[model samples]
Target chain A: MALTASDVTIHFGGVVAVNGMALDVMPGEIVGLIGPNGAGKTTFINCLSGTYRPNTGTALWQGDELIGLSPSALLRKGVARTFQNVASLHDLTVLDIAKLGAGVRRDRRTGGHLLDFFRSDRALEELLMESILAPLELNDVAHKPIQTLSYGRRKAVDLARALAGDPQLLLLDEPVAGLTSHEGMAMAAAVRDVRDRHGCAVIMVEHKMDVVMSTCDRVAVMAAGSKIFEGRPAEVQADPEVRRVYLGEP
Target chain B: MSTRHIAIAIGVAVVMAVLAVVLGRYGAYLVNAVAIAAIGALSLNLLIGYCGQISFAQGALLGVGAYTAGNLGNAGLDGAVAILGAGVLGALVSALIGLPAMRLRGLYFAIATLAAQAILEYLFKILDPLTNGVSGLVIKPPSIFGIPMTSDESLVLPSLVLLVIAWLVVSRLLRTDLGRAFLVVRESEIVAKGMGIDVGHTKLWAFLIGGFIAGMAGALIGFANRLASPEAFTLDLSADYIAMIIIGGLGTWPGPIIGAAFVVLLPEVIQRVGEAAGISDILSALRELAFGLLIILFLIFEPRGLTALLSRIKLRRIGVVPPAGLRATGEGSQSPEGRSR
Candidate 1:
């Protein structure tokens, strides 16, 4: 397993946000986490990404413990995540955000990083546009400020930023939730393409069942604050308890 | 960089050089004052405008530079060495102050800086041995290879050169990853951290860089006036520097220069107007009133500052259409609602 998260748990006031959430993801695999409203799917992903510290649990990525590490530290450890709501920075263009992502990547090949102080990152800018932005159809507005991009495009830019970092474990929160059907499909395809190219493990928290079924190799279903079912997508859809709690079958 | 930006820079440089050569002694002195003020404004902007960190202690940091330069110069150190020492001290002091305070957000940070300003001011007066007990120290004119640059006319070219170098260094830094990291931290520390940026370290860098630049500005001021006085760098001076960036526009490269020139030259213009009208006494009182009123008006009508106003006019003249995203009406101008469909 590239990532093994065991007994991960967190609480907010009296309510449990996540309870004993355990997951294992192999390299180059996509695991979709789906749950109803108030389920702990997003909360579990947050725990793994270092956004929130679980009250008790341990997540090991490549055999290194990830508890108590900061988000930046996680990124340095080759774990990166995309936000559910894309960040629309003032005065920064799409290309600029992607470049920011490129700045944090752990496996930089260059020897003299400080030499970057003297020259413009025009080469990185071009490469990002070609590899990351082009696939998402964001190249057209690459130079436009993120605040000026449409809702769907900004989300794409957020994904572009995450991909630019070349993470070993990618955590995406609703990557295609706000996008059009066509854009959603394209985003799903792009996610798969990135996994194939980078051979990185992925844990995606999503509400859209169609996208998850098509994109995820494995699926986990959550209810309240614990995992209720874990199986292949077809098996998850077929499970009676999952159908009762999540799918709302009579 | 764009050709248009380069053209504008070169044109501005030529105009300033020509003005330096053609102006009389008093005009040259005023120009030197504005140049030094511009450097300070630029430094403040790096924190407040670019990094979104509020600081009310810039004037104190400027004093630190001035005193360092003054003491070193008095000890017979070379001018370059004195200025460099000031920058080093400024960086160290700012980092030390910022380490604890940068964790505070918004108004809390501002208040912390306000406290720093008061503390530094008291130190300047209480540390009598080094600062001469508020009597202040006179700075000798700097020399370059045996040539003394004492007169205002003689110093104008050097001041202009220093301003140009400052501009180049800042602009180049903005083009690098470090600059983008500053912007990310400004936008949201949570997001910045998620993106692998060390928020605390980035904020520290902002303060260090800002203090160093402000210190250099102080050294220039000391060189220009031949004095490093505590009274010259009061809380009011810090407020004025903040107003310069706000009125001139924030985050834009040329905003601070334009703002400093406006702030420094406005009083002289008001005084001259008063003299011409034979009502100098009344105009002196009106100076403060005019400054306040102008700031209010700019905030009301052009909250984005003079840079946005200029850009709007240029965009109109060029007949460029606004982007589709901006054309959306109402709350759509804000980032799309984070709601998932």
Candidate 2:
């Protein structure tokens, strides 16, 4: 298995946001996590990404404990994530963000970034431009500042940034939440393509049921902070308890 | 930066060197003052403008350089070596001042820097043996190689050369991965962390590099005046540099040089204009008032500074709508809103 996270629990003051959540994903498998608002779908992903520390749990990635590492440390270990909202305050070009992603992925054990002074970055820039930006359709506006782009394109840029590092475990939070259907479909296809090319494990937390059903290899349902149902997409849709809790059926 | 940018820098250096040689004594002195101020402003811009770490201890930091160079020169070291020693010490001291910045940010980090300035100023007054107390230390006119640079005309060359070096170094840094990391840290540290950038490390580098340049400028000031005094480096001096960078264009590369010249020359121009207007009797009193008023007006009408205003005018020449109020956040910047700078 690529990832095995079990018995994860967290609380914010008096509220338990995620309670005893467990999940496992094999290499190259795509796992979809879906639930209603305030159901801790994002909270659980946050735990895995090192944005928050769960009170008690163990997340083993290839037998390494992954709970306490920083987000940057996790990136060094081949883990990366995409945010739900791409901040528009940054005025950098799409290529700039891609370069930043690629920069952190380099094994800087010898001299750190000090040797970056002597190194020419032409090859890295060209590689990111061709391999990373081209596939996501971001090559057209690769030089434009991200603040000038439309919302959908900015979302694509965020995905491009994550994939720049060639992550082995990709955690995506609401990748298609604010996108139009056309953009959403394109983002879904890109995720599938990434998995095929990299053979990396993916755990996507999203609200769009159709995209989840079509893209995910297996579906996990959560309600009130715990996993309520786990099965294939077809099995998940037919389950009566999932329908009542997730779809508001009486 | 491109090869074209490098070419333009060399061209400017050559032209400025020629002008410094041709100008009279007072003109050389004025050019030296502006060049020194520009170097200091460039350092501040790197911290607050590019790295998003606001500092108010710049004046004390410069004082730290001045005193170090003064002591080194008095000890019989070469002038160039003294200046470089000052830079190394300044970098260490700046990293010390930036320790709080590893935890504080925005207005709070700015306040911590303010406290640091106050403390350093006090130290300069009380460190009698080293600082020569409130009386200041008299610096020997150290030689560059073997030639004594006793006149303003002779000193202008070193000042201009250092200015060019500082400019190119800053420009080159922005193109490197470390420089891009600075911009990301500026936008938001949380975003920086998500991208696997160590926020503390980037901020520390900002302080180190900026402090080193400030130290070099301070050493030049010590050599120029032949003294290092507590009064020469004060809270007001820090405010003057902050004004220079802000009025020039914040993070814009040319902002510091343009702002420095304007700030240094403004009083001289006022004095000349007042004399020309036959108001010599009251001009001295009114000049300071007018200067304060102009700064206030600029902040209100053009917070983005003269760089943005000039660019706007250039764009207007071709019938394009000028985005006049956008602060120079970084390269290719044109944001609708302004930050705390």
Candidate 3:
């Protein structure tokens, strides 16, 4: 398994945000986490990404415990995440943000750090333009500051940033939450493409049913901070309790 | 740098050199003042503009450099050794001040720096054996080989050389990964940490680099004035250095130089105008008032400083469109909005 998180539990005041959340994903597989609002899907992703420390948990990535590492530490360990709300940076071009992502990659080319003092970033710029920005269809506005882009384009930039690192385990929080249907479909396709190319495990917390159904190799359902069901997408849709609580079937 | 940037730099250098040779003694003195101020302003800009750390201890730090150089020079050390020694001391003192920066930010961080200034200033007076207290110490003219650099004309070249070195160091550093990390920390520490940068360490580096430059500026000042006095570095001097960077344009490489020249030359220009109009008394009384008003006007009308204003003019002349999302108001464009999720 690429990631095996078990008995992950966290509490905020008296409320248990996530309790006994257990998940396992094989290499190159995409796991869709689907649930109602406040079901701890994002909370679980946050725990795995090191944004929140679960009070009790065993989150092992490739056999290493990821309980107390910082976000940057996790990133260096080949784990990266995208925010639900994309951050709009002033004075920084889309390409610049992508470069920042590429800058932290563990396998960055030799002398990239040292050469930055005396050399232009043209080579890395070209590489990122072709590999990351072009795939996201953000090449046209790559030189423009991120704040100038449309909301959908900004969301794409966020995804591009995460992908630039070529992470082993990608955690996405509502990657398609506010995008149009076309954008959402494109984003889901990109996630699949990333999985195929990098052979990385992905745990995507999303509310879009069609996206989850089409993109995920497996599905997990959560309600009130605990996993209620785990199965194939079709099986998840057919589960009686998932149908009653999440799919709204009588 | 591109060919165009190189050409511009060379052109500026040639103009300054010619001005130094042709201008009378007073002009050379003024140029030296501009150069010294530029060094301090540039260092302060690194902390305030790029790293987003407000430091009010620059004046005290300058005093530290000046006293170190002056006392060492009086003790028969080579001028180069004194200046370098001062720089090393400045970096150490700045790192000490930066310890508190890890726990404070914004106004609180600024207050801590202010306290550092107060403590250092008091130490300068109490450590009378080293600093010579309120009486101050006389500085010997720094010599290169056997030639003494005594006159303003001679000092102008050294001052200009120091300024160029300061500019080159800062500009080069800004292009490096460490510089980019500084910008990230300034924009958002959370994002910086997320990207694997140690925010505290970056801030400390900023302080160290800034203090080193400030120390170099102090050594230059001691060389120019032939004295290292406590009165020369006061809270007001620190405020002026801050004003120079703000009025020039923060974060832009040329901003400090431009701002320093403006701050240094304005008073001399006012004095000249007063003498010519036979109203020296009135103008002397209003000098401080005029300085305050100018800063206010610039802040209100051109908050990005002269650098942004110049760029806007250049863009207009070239008929190029400004970046689309830039806000209409000058002050709004400078705000750190949309920096965080």
Candidate 4:
């Protein structure tokens, strides 16, 4: 398995945000985690990605401990994630954001200061630019600062940045939560395309049923922070417990 | 970056040197004072402009350096060693201040630095043995490499040379990895950390660098005056350094120089007008009032500074259409690609 979380739980004061959540994602697999609003899908992702410390249980990536690491530590260990809120995201071009992701890898071995002369070199930057942006069809606007782009284009840019890190596993927190149906399908196909090209594992946290059902190879359903169902997307669609928790008294 | 840029810089230096020779003593004194201020202002720019740390301790550090230099000079340490000793003292004091104040942010950071200034001034008052306190200390002028530079015209040459050295340090830093990290930290500490930047260490380095430059400037200023006084390193002087960076444009290579020239020359020009009109005190007050108003106006309307405005005008003049993202606002848009994700 590329990544596994066994019996993970998190608490905020007295409230249990995530309770006994178990998940596994294999290499090149696109696994979906879905639930209704406030069901703690993001909290689970945060626990796995080192944004929050799990109160109990273990998170492992290829048998290495994934819990208790800082976000940068996780990033250096070959895991990088994009935030849902995306704070401090001003004035940077598409390439610049991608360069930040590229910066993560550079800082891993060489201290950032020493890498200045080579990091932003034209040839290497162009290569990274092509690999990350061309897949998202963002090559045309690569030089343009992200602020000028449409919401859809900006989302594409964010994805490109994550891809720039050359991550072994991508934990996408609702990659297309508010996108139009066309954009959603494009994003889903792009996710699949990235997996195919890079052979990276994916764990998608999403609420869109159409996206989860169509794109996910395997689906896990959450109800009140615990994994209530896990199987093929078709099994998840028919699970009575998932329906009762998400779709209301079935 | 290119050979052509270096050539042009050398050409400018030659012209400035010729101008100093023609203008004589009074002009040299003006140039010397301005050069020292520029060095101090540029150092502060690294912290305030590039690293986004708002500090008002430049003047206090300057005072520390001057006192150190004055004391050292009196003890027969002489020229270069005395100046170097002063810089070391400034760095040590600055590091001590940064250790606690680094934990504070925003208004708290400002207050902490202000308190540092107050404490330093108090020390200067209470410690009469070392500092001479209220009476201050007067010393002989420096003779560099056994060459006596008694006249203002001769002093200007060395001061200009120091300014050039300060400029080189700033240029080298802006192009280095450490420099880019400084910019990154200023832009977003969170993002910088994610990219494996040690934010605390970076800020400390900034404080040290700024202190070192301010220290050097202080030594020069004290040497020029042939005296070290507590009043010379007041909060107003710190505010003036901040003003220089703001007017020049923060985070740009040329901005600090532009800012230094304006702040240094403004009072002189005002004094000249006052002399012609036979009204000295009113002219001085008018200059102070003008400086205060400019600070307020720039902070409100053109916070990105003179460099940003100049860039916009340059772009318009060149008829190079701004990128769609850059067109909406001069500061760039909020959270752009990162926010959407």
Candidate 5:
């Protein structure tokens, strides 16, 4: 098993964002986290990814507790995540973002690794270009800044960045939320490719039902910050609770 | 940076050195002032421009360097060793200032650094043995490689070489992973954390490295002036360095040098123009007034700095539409590699 999160809960003043969230994923598994808008899908990912510490949780990843660890520490443990909306950074190119991903993968030793200073980026640039960017079809605009790219392409670059980290456990938060349908399908396909290539466990929070069905091996449904249902994608589609809460079925 | 950027740095250094030597004492003094300002400007750019740490403590940081180098030089150390000692001390002090930055950010952090500047300035005035209080520390000329640099002409080459080293270090640093982390941190700390960057550590490194460079520039100033005084490193000096980088195009390459030259020579050019026009009586008043007005104009009309302005002119002269990214960013002529310089 790669990640096993249980009883994860967090609150903001009077509101409980993620309450008693439980999840598990084995190596090479793709788990889809689906629900209505306020289901705390992203908040749960935040708990695992170290953006927020849960008030209650025991998230064990590869036998180590991950709840209190920082995002940088979790990354060294091979856990990486993408954003819901890609932030436009000034002057950084597609290759630059991918390079940043690959950079975090190096050394993985405890403490700040000063060795990165001695290492030349050119050596890894070729490898990143071949493996991450080329596969994402970002080779053409590898030098262009992310801000100048279309909304769809920027999202693709964000995925390329996450994948370059060579993660053992990847958390993608709405990877295709803002993309066109055609772009969305390409992103979904890319997600599957990453799973096949790296054999890493993935927890993807997405709103696109088609993407969730086609790309996910298993689906987990949430309602009001609790897991309402969990099963294979077909079973999830057939479940009445998931339909009423997520698919707007009366 | 790649080997090509390193080559460009060396070439620019050589050109600067030649210009320093050929320009007589007055011109070399101007060159020396510009070069030193460029070094200070680059350090501030790395902190404020690249790392997005708005510091009003640069003048104090430079003062730290000047005092350290002065004391070391007076104690019979070689000029090289004194400068190095200054840099190391600057890094340590800079890290100390950066501690609050770990907890505070933006306007709050800027205020904290301002407080640091005030505290350091107070220390400079009260620390009699080292700083010699308000009178300043007067020292014998420091020697590099056993040769005393007694004149501004003698200091020109060393200043240019130091500027070159500082430039190369900053450029090479930007290409490194830590340097890229600074950019991400600049954009958004939350995004930086999500990307797995230790934001606090990265900011500290920026302060340390920037302090080191600022210290080196301070060392050069101490050598040139042969005095280290509290008055020399006031908040006004800090604001001046800030203005240099802002007028130079915050994070652009060569922006510091252009901004530094403009800042250091504006008064001189204004004075010369007034004298030539038989207005010598009002030269000083006009110089100060014109200098203030021009910087204001640059800030309003060319906020991206003269580099972006030159780039726009070059683009127009060539009559070719720039790429979307270049157009959007408003940066100057990019290196062929299309990466950060």
Candidate 6:
């Protein structure tokens, strides 16, 4: 397993946010976490991303303990996440944010210089623009500041920032939320391409059923802070329990 | 980058030099004060404008540098050495202060910096022998490259040169990747951290750079006055520094210069108005009161400072109507195209 979570539990005061959640992500596969509102889907991603510390159990990346690490530390461990509410970076261009992601993977000594002297080593930035951003058809607005982009484009930039880290495992929170239908499919295609090109594990928390069905290799269903089922995307669709919990089927 | 900018800069420099020469001793004194204050104001602008950190301790850092220079000068050190020592000492102390406190945010950090200013001022007062207590220390005129600058006209040339150097350094630094990192930290720590930026370290660096500028300014002021007194580095001085940055435009290079000129000239204008009204003292008091009120007003309405306001006006004149897209959020947003559009 490239990433694994065993009996992870987190509580806010007396209320349980994530309870005894266990998940395993194999290398080079995209896993989907699907749930209703307040189902603790984002909460699980938060624990994995080190935004929230789990009260019990372990989160491991390649058998190294991943719980309680800072976001930057986790980034060093080759894990990265995108935010649902995107950050506002007013002074930088699109390339700047991309460079920031690349900067995370870079050693402090090499990248700390006032200028990017080793720009050749940072081919990932160019690759990201062409492969991920361009295929998402964000080329026309690639030079714009993130704030000037539409909500759909901003979310794409967020994904691009995550990709810049060259992460071994990527955690995405609502990657297609707020996007137009055309943009949503384009983003979904980009996610697939990122996995195809990078061979990285992906754990996505998404509300878009069409995206999950089409993009994810395996689907994990959650309801009220606990995973009810885990199987292939087709099996997940066939499972009556998942259908009842998430789709309101009998 | 533009011919107009170059022309304006050159014109201003010539006018300032001529003013120093043509205007008598009193005018030279005011010009010197403005030049020194502009250096300090620019330093604060780095923190206040670019880094989005408000500091009230710039004047205190300036005081520290001035005292260091004065003491070193009294010990029979050469002018250049004394001035250099003052700046180095001030930067060291400010960097030390930043190391622990840069982790904080908002009003909490501001309060910590203010407290630092208060404590430093007290230290200056308590160290009577070194700082000469509240009595202050008298310094001799500084000599640069065998040229004696004892008189106001002689001092003006050096002051203007230092001001230009300060402006150039600040301008150049803001265009680099390090400058972009400072802005990244200022915008959101979470985003910065996510991008693998050492947010704490970046904040500390900003504080250090700002302090270095303030320290250099302090050295210049000390040389101009040939004295170091506790009264020279008071809370009032700190407030004046804050006022200069706020009025000028905060983050832009020209903001501090304009702010320094306004604050320095406003008092003279008020004195004249006060003389005409036969309430000179009250008029001066009102100016001080107005200075404080202006800070509050800027915070409420135009926190981006005069530069942003002017840019908007210019845009309007060019027949460009800005969309009401992101202005509702107050803070400026960068477009995906990378401009601050």
Best by DockQ: 2
What would the per-residue lDDT of candidate 5 be over residues B1-341, giving only the tens digit for each residue?
56776787678767767777788788788888989999999999999888989999999999999999999999999998999999999989999988899999888999999999999999999999999999999966999878898988888888888998898888878877888889999888888888887888889889989999999999998998899999999998998888888778777877888888888888788778888998877886765566567668766666567777777777778987666445422432242322231
Ranking by DockQ: 2, 1, 5, 3, 6, 4
Model 2 Cα lDDT, one tens digit per residue, A114-214: 77866788998889988989999999998887887888899888888888888999999999998999999999999999899889999999889889998
For each candidate, what's the DockQ? 0.53, 0.62, 0.41, 0.31, 0.53, 0.40
DockQ pick, better of 2 and 6: 2
What is the lDDT, from 0 to 100, of the residue A155 in candidate 1?
85
Give the higher-TM-score candidate: 4 or 6: 6
| Cα displacement (Å) at residue B160, model 4 | 4.1
Worst 10 residues of 5 chain B by lDDT: B332-341
Could you tell me the fnat of model 3? 0.36
Query: For candidate 3, what TM-score does chain B get against the true chain B?
Result: 0.91
- Listed per prediction, chain B TM-scores read 0.90, 0.93, 0.91, 0.89, 0.91, 0.89
- Enumerate residue pairs that collide in model 2: none
> How many clashes would you count in candidate 2?
0
- Chain B, candidate 1: TM-score: 0.90
| Model 2 chain B worst lDDT run, 10 consecutive residues | B322-331
Second chain of candidate 2: TM-score?
0.93
Q: Summarize candidate 1's per-residue lDDT along A1-250 as a digit string, tens digits.
A: 8999899999999999999989999999999999998998888888888889999999999999997888877887889899898876876778888988878764332423346676667788889999889988899988777887778788889888988887899999989998898889888998999999889999999988899999999999989889999999999999999999988674
TM-score of chain A of 2: 0.96
C-alpha lDDT of residue A112 in model 1 = 34
lDDT tens digits by residue: candidate 4, B191-305: 6765545667778877887788778788888788888778888898899999998887665566676788789999999998999999977999887788888877777656656
Off by over 4 Å in 3: A106-120, B1-3, B145-147, B320-341
In model 4, what are the clashing residue pairs, if there are any?
A89-B335
Using TM-score as the measure, which candidate wins?
2
C-alpha RMSD over true interface residues, model 3: 3.9
